[model samples]
Target: MNFFKTTYTSKLVFTALVIFSSSCSDDYLEEMTYGEISPSEMTSPGNVDRAIIAAYSLLNGQYDASSSAFNSPASNWSFGDVVSDDAYKGGGGTGDQNNIHLMEIFNTNPTIIDIERKWVALYEGVKRTNEAMRLLQNSQEYDVALKENRMGELYFLRGHYYFELKKIYNTIPYIDETAATVNDYAVSHTQYTSEQLWDKIEENFSNAYERLPNDQEEVGRPNKMTAKAYLAKTYIFQGQWQNALDAANEVINSNKYSLLPNFRDVFLPENDNSSEIIFAVQHSVLDGAPDNYNGSIGDRLSAPGGPFYSQYGFHRPSQNLVNAYKTNAIGMPVLDNKNLAEADFVDPRLDHTVGRPGIPYLDLGVLYEASWARDLSTYGPFAPKKRIVSANSPYQIKTWPYISALNYYIIRYADLLLWKAEALVELGDLEGARAVVNQVRGRAKDSQYVMNLEGTTPAASYRIETYNTPWTDQATAREAVRTERRLELALEGHRFFDLVRWGVAAETINAYLEVEKTRRTHLTNANFIEGTHNYFPVPQKYLDYLASTK
Candidate 1:
């Protein structure tokens, strides 16, 4: 349980040396000590454990090495949500975090700080995992099965890091343990095709699935089902529908996870490691760090300004997202491009996921007013709610930038279910996909709905029901599943990636901007070009580094 408590400063120093040596002359590199420990010294089991912990530490995507906390957030809030239709960059103004603003408006370039910082953070994760794997491979004193299990965890971590890199940059150099020299580390991004990069990512998860245990004693460590879940996700991203469906079925058949009874409870600190979570970036407060950096530091800017919360409000939900929650008289989504009117019945999950005007903000004893939003005119009136811990909760830190020990789920059971549903739809199992989607909807329908200020009545005319009718058409079923993903996982840092994977980022985001620009003037000139904007440009620094080597 104390797996995350250890610090891996020496490992980080070693990683820095490896990258630094890549630029040094042969004589200078030969004189330098590349690592804190020699290969013989790393043979200790304790050293290997520390190395593994070091790899896991990068999951939050924040370190002393990073330039800004928000630039490299573990949750992908900036790249995934803000860049998509789910959210807007809600800070001081349009100029505040202008780099992110550039991203939100689809005016991104390789020089943007967020692009570089995120690349660095994810690659740092890759380095830590590689270092851990190296140590584990060299170690002789560790238990055989335990060593394999630890290796499995390391592979899973690396797979996750590379997956993020692949989705964000589209092309990246793949470095593994065999890469000992500068040239090996500087392998060209174009060396592998897109399909090959996915294959590499899938190999890691497959290794993990083969080696990991069914259950892990440590809470944060991934298990067999977790690997399988990720494999399913990876396969879906590759459009390998059969492979994805098979992997998903393996996890779903295990019945190891289910939806939490209450939709809102999933994000609570107390339920950080709940059964609904497949894997999450585990956060801790007051874990002896100078600041609460080990907490949700990446999401610190997302706190809504109010009587009970910090003032640096960012990651405001979009009005489009709010409107997407509107349900018809039959308690199903409206599935149109209309604005949300006061009397429109909405899915109850809306209140749990977003903070709208007049709704009680998570039992804070006060209604969420427009004043809680930092920049209402630029980002609209909504505030992010799902990931924010209750102000009264013990998990929240009483500090300047109020962070909380709320774990950000990388993959939740509901997300996995949706992936399964998506795969089913692609595989032409419309009924199967409907049943899975309904399983998710049934939980939302049965869960406790958000209440009014007095806690006496339902907050809005909340109504959501599963599809009672059969899904007959593939196109309709596909849209239904995709829409379900948007509503169920809104503002959770998966929107943009989902759109890109679905090959609708250009169409969807352009259409979103066409209407959203009218509502928020900042997006007046925003555009999403198909080929150029599919992935962020490779970081200028990385390209420069590659150039220097040449």
Candidate 2:
């Protein structure tokens, strides 16, 4: 989640006395109500709009970072690609390999901050929505559906936040209503077990699906399609295959979104988003906002800000990922053994997976300088990924608050296809899975890899064009889909969770754990078995707080 993606209420810093000066004396620490505007005064039309804006901020920024980072460790990507195991902030420092997060994850890892802030901000949104719903429910100021839609969005968002929260923490103090004091947070937010949370999540998503206006294609908020898609995803996570299939089918049949003609443009800021993106973090440098830090969180992840510029590598693609990029005996990216012609038949998805040295970072900052980022020329050797924008580019070239854009896809149409394929596999309908994976395969052509005709100019030197192999059998088809997903969505917060949800994390991570045990250098002796550390230990402090309070 990019913080600078939108304007927000100024920080409300109260004196230290306020935190510890508990008393009935209201004058001790003057309530610093969010940059001067009190919650009470925000009932006016303009302020309501601002409240809505803040709500949008909550959904995009805080909500996403927490959900993505710790809900699943980045080790999957870092380790999958063999980039950096230590990238896992809590991924134990390999006794042999000095993990960087130990030193880097300080008081400001967005993962931690986002989790805390998302919880509070989401409740703030609930308060505003509750107020708006109450006011509009009784007045003739606006259309009922308009108010209903707004409230419904608020409900869906709360439900979504809870879903994310529950995924991370089993028993949280669920706060559905507006909170007035810290004590109001006493009751457990989640009134049920994971099973109940799933049930409630489905209900809220259903409510959102029914009420969100399909008519408005707003830049930030989730629409009917996304609501359904998200519900479908929740179902996927919970292992509710048929339910997942049902919602996915609804999204596909809706015909509301389609794949962009070109793939890479999907991430381009100028593009806002691909036709396939059902919901995205609305961000623009020109969105009438000043330079913000959240907007540049990835500054250290891309060029100019990364190896291209900095002393530290913000992101590291791993060996599994590099291995995933290798060509096979049949001149393809995947096979029993990739020892074929040593051709470029490697999965075209490689560029999208890991960075090498040749691929171009598509100058995503078209919203700012058209090409402040450059990787296309390939003063070239191996292919380099464009996931991080300012990693190589220097801070001087960027800015303390550089102007970048963020339109993170909370859910996209492509995911629906993936869901459908997964449903097919689970349903024992592998052919259906093949159909879905093949479509995604076709698009990688222009985005990352290009293929050449047999007798074409560059000859065999570099003329080998990307061949979308239309696989025949179901077994091969199932493998194709799995491999495609592993490669395609490599890092966008899916790997670890996917492996866990698929009931494979134990097998996979255990293998890596064993591998690390051997190195015994910097990353040696580190151990992650099937259970212990995979799931959080219910934050001991939270338990301690509960025990004493109870």
Give me the candidate number with maximum lDDT. 1
- For residues 140-214, could you state the per-residue lDDT of candidate 1 as single tens digits? 798998998999999999999999999999999889877655566676888999999999999999999999999
Candidate 2 residue lDDT tens string, 1-550: 2333445432222122121123432331133444555545545555554545545554433323222222222112222223222123212232212332322211122233333333444444444444444443444445556766776676677676666556544455555444444454446544577787778778888888888888564456677887988889899988888988988998888988877766655655655555788776554443443334334333223332232343223334433445565554343455332222434556555544444433333333111121222322111122224344433332222443443554556566676788888877777776677678666665654443422223233212122133355545656666656666666666554565566566666676556545543432333434445554343334333333445555
* Residue 255 local lDDT, model 1: 91
Candidate 2 Cα misplacement greater than 4 A, ranges: 1-33, 36-40, 60-143, 178-181, 189-191, 286-291, 294-312, 329-344, 358-384, 390-397, 401-403, 446-479, 513-522, 537-550
Score candidate 2 by TM-score against the native.
0.74
| Native-to-model Cα distance after best TM-score fit, residue 327 in candidate 1, in Å | 0.8
Which one is best on TM-score?
A: 1
The worst-scoring run of ten residues by lDDT in candidate 2 lies at: 12-21
* lDDT per model vs. reference: 0.85, 0.49
